[model samples]
Every structure is written in structure tokens, then in C-alpha cells.
Target: MDRPHWSVPLALVWVSSFFLHFAWEMWQVVFYEGMATASHAAAIWICTKATFGDANIALAAYLAAALSVCSIDWVRTPTGTPLFFYLAAGLLITVLFEYLATEVLGRWEYNEQMPTLPLLGTGLLPLAQWIVVPLVSLYATRLMYFGFLPMREYAANKPA
Candidate 1:
């Protein structure tokens, strides 16, 4: 089988990740102190910047998965070890960044509404965001790459 051009999956990963993370960030803003009080434009700008960062993280995770599986096309049939790498990389990056931003750098603070882990104190929503958004992004990438049809049907009907 011909290998897909690298750009295809990368582009899909970025686009899907950006939009999904943008929505997640905007929705979870209320959990962050001062975000609810911020001007609409300011909130949007902050979320947009964060979304770009999230998208970059997603791309990095995707690349890690690809490297683990030795296939750029792994997103098409994500499972087992590659999927583990993707999730692990995203979670690790998110945990470290969240700790730094919240504790060390003072980049942001969780409001009273935010539920946090005990030791790390990372916000639950952000951790959930990293887990949920990347999986959904990968699924969306697969659907977009393989068309709207179900994967099994698409595979069976595809021409050899």
C-alpha cells in the first residue's frame, strides 16, 4: 500500500485538535479564577492562545504514536501500543505544564469551582480535556481521512 503523505494526518490533527481544544478551553474557563470576570475579547484571546498550545501538544502526541507504531498511517487504525503512546504523551505534557502554570509560574489559578487532584493540584477539567480531546481528535481524523462511511464497511468495499 502507498503510504499517505505526512501532511495529510498532520493537517487533520492540527485542525481537529485546535477546534476541539478551543471549545473545551472556552467552556472550562469558568473554573479558572478571573476568567468569568474578564472581558469577552480578553477571554477569547486567552482561550485562543491556549487552544494553539493544545493543538501543538496534540500534534506532538500524534507524532509520538506514529513513532511507536512505525507508521504515519497509524491514526487510521489506532489501537494497542500506539494509542497508549498518544494518550501517555498528552497526559504527561499536560500534567507537567498544568503544574508549572498553576504552581510555579503563576500563569493561571483555579477558582473555587475547580476540582483538583490532591497532590498535583492540577484542575480536573484540564486533565479530562487532555484525555478526551485527543481521543476525539484522533477519531475525527480517522473519519475525515476514511470518509463518512463506517471503517469496516469502507475497508471491505475499498478497491484493492
Candidate 2:
């Protein structure tokens, strides 16, 4: 089989990551921040888009890490990374983004409403949000593209 091109898969992953992260961030903000007021539609939309930007930053970080690894011996292609390594790269990248965005850049703030880890001083929801949503998105994308899940196979060979 020919090696798969990196562009399409990377685009798909980028979009999937954006939406997945946006949805999870929206959920957390609504439930925890009490920002679900009917009048807050515009605010909700803005917040959702901000999270989308965050997701895009994460995708860039992941792709950078993947390309860096691809330059190494074992992983030769950008898309050839193992899932575990991909996830680990994303986690580390996102943690750094979170720290810089919250602590350094003052882009956003987390209140007492968010569950904080002792040493990290960061919310658990945001940290876990990257993990759960991206993994599910990747799994679903794999199932769709690779036919990994069990399903009825239609036979083209058998004809009446």
C-alpha cells in the first residue's frame, strides 16, 4: 500500500480536535461557571470560539512534536506516530499552553469553582478535557477510516 499523505489526515485531526475541545470547554464553563443564562448566548458563543483557538494551539503543538519525532529514527512519517506518543505529546503541550495562557499571558482565569490540583494550581477539568475528547475523536476517526469496529461486510463476489 502506498504511504498515506499527511495533509488530509492532519486536517481531519485538527478539525476533530477543535470541535471536541470546544464542546468539552463549553460544558465545563456552563456547569461550573454558571454562564448558562438565556441572555448569555453571545457570551457562550465567544467563549466557545476562544476554546477553539486553544484547541488550534494544541493541534499546532501536537503536529510540531509529531514532526520532531518523525525526524527521529523510528517514526519516519508525521502521521506514523503511535497513539500513546501522540496523546502524551498533546498532554504535555496542552499543559504548557494552559500554564502560559493562564499564568503568564493572563488570557483567562479559573475560579474556585474549578477543581484544582495541589501543586499544579490548575483545574482538573481543563487538563482532562484534552485527554478524553481527543482520544474519543481519534478512536472514532480510526473506526471510520480503517474499519476497525466489527460490522456486517457486504460481499461483492456473491451474485444471484
Candidate 3:
């Protein structure tokens, strides 16, 4: 059967991104006292910020995967482009963006409960989620729809 339209995948990615980031933040709240004692408004504000930020990250990941996959034929898979590409690009983008935001820009801070990683100087949970969430999103999207239907159709229609 044919897969759903491009919007289907996009919606899926967007919703998944929101939920994943919220959950990540909650994990921090529980373990790292990350706003755990904050008032209801503070918690909502924090989650809202994370959701917005992650939405952008998700969009960047999709863009990077689509652009990279278009140039490299080997990366294409039956259902879509390779999930690994998305995962790798997502991780790289998220890590760099988050590292700058937290460490360099001083936009955010991690608590003592956060697990640190060498070189990254960031929490293990955040870095790991970039890998986990993107992989899950890509895999789920592929299962639900074909890989980038518009691009696939264009390539099929282009001159041999």
C-alpha cells in the first residue's frame, strides 16, 4: 500500500519531538531537581521552552537528513533514507546546539544530578536522547509512510 503524504511524516516528527523533550525534561526534574520544586507556572514555562526548542531541532534533523540523503544514493533505504543518517545528524545538531546554549551562551544550566560526559561537558540524558528520539522518530515514520514521498516521486520522474 502507498504511504501517507509528506504532512503525515512531518506531523509525526513534530509531535514526537514535543513529547520526547517534555519527557526528557521531566526525567531531569525527577533526578536532578530540575525545577522539581518550582511552582506550576515555572514548570509549564520550562516545558514550553523545551518544546519549542526541540521543535526546531526536529525540523533541522529532517532538513539535514533530506539534504544529505538526496546527495548520497547509498544512504537510501526501501522505506526511506537510512535511519542512521537521521540519528547521526540529529545527534550532531542537537549536541552542538545544546552545548552552545547551555555551556557557551549560558542560556541554561545543569544540576549536580545530571550525569556528565567527557569532552561534551553536558548531561548524559540530553546527549543520549538526541540519539534515541531521532532514531525512534525516523523508524516510526518509515513504518507509517514511505521515505520523503515528494523527493522519491521526483527522483522517479526525472530523466534516466
In order of appearance, the predictions have TM-scores of 0.92, 0.68, 0.72
Instruction: Please tell me which predicted candidate would have the highest TM-score against the true structure.
Output: 1
**Candidate 2: 10-residue stretch with minimal lDDT:** 149-158
The models' CA-based lDDT, in order, is 0.92, 0.61, 0.67
lDDT of 2 by residue, 66-137 (tens): 665663211222244555566677677677766787778976667667776687666788778767876766
Candidate 1 structure, TM-score to reference: 0.92
Evaluate residue 154 in candidate 2 and report its C-alpha lDDT on the 0 to 100 scale.
19
Query: In what order do the candidates fall by TM-score, top score first?
Result: 1, 3, 2
Note each model's CA RMSD in angstroms. 3.0, 6.9, 6.6
Clash pairs of candidate 3? Answer: none
Position 152, candidate 1: lDDT: 74
Stretches of candidate 1 exceeding 4 Å from the true structure: 154-160
Clash-forming residue pairs, model 1: none
Task: Give the residue spans of candidate 3 off by over 4 A.
Answer: 31-34, 71-81, 143-160
Cα distance off (Å), candidate 2, residue 82: 2.6
Error of 3 at 49 (Å): 1.4
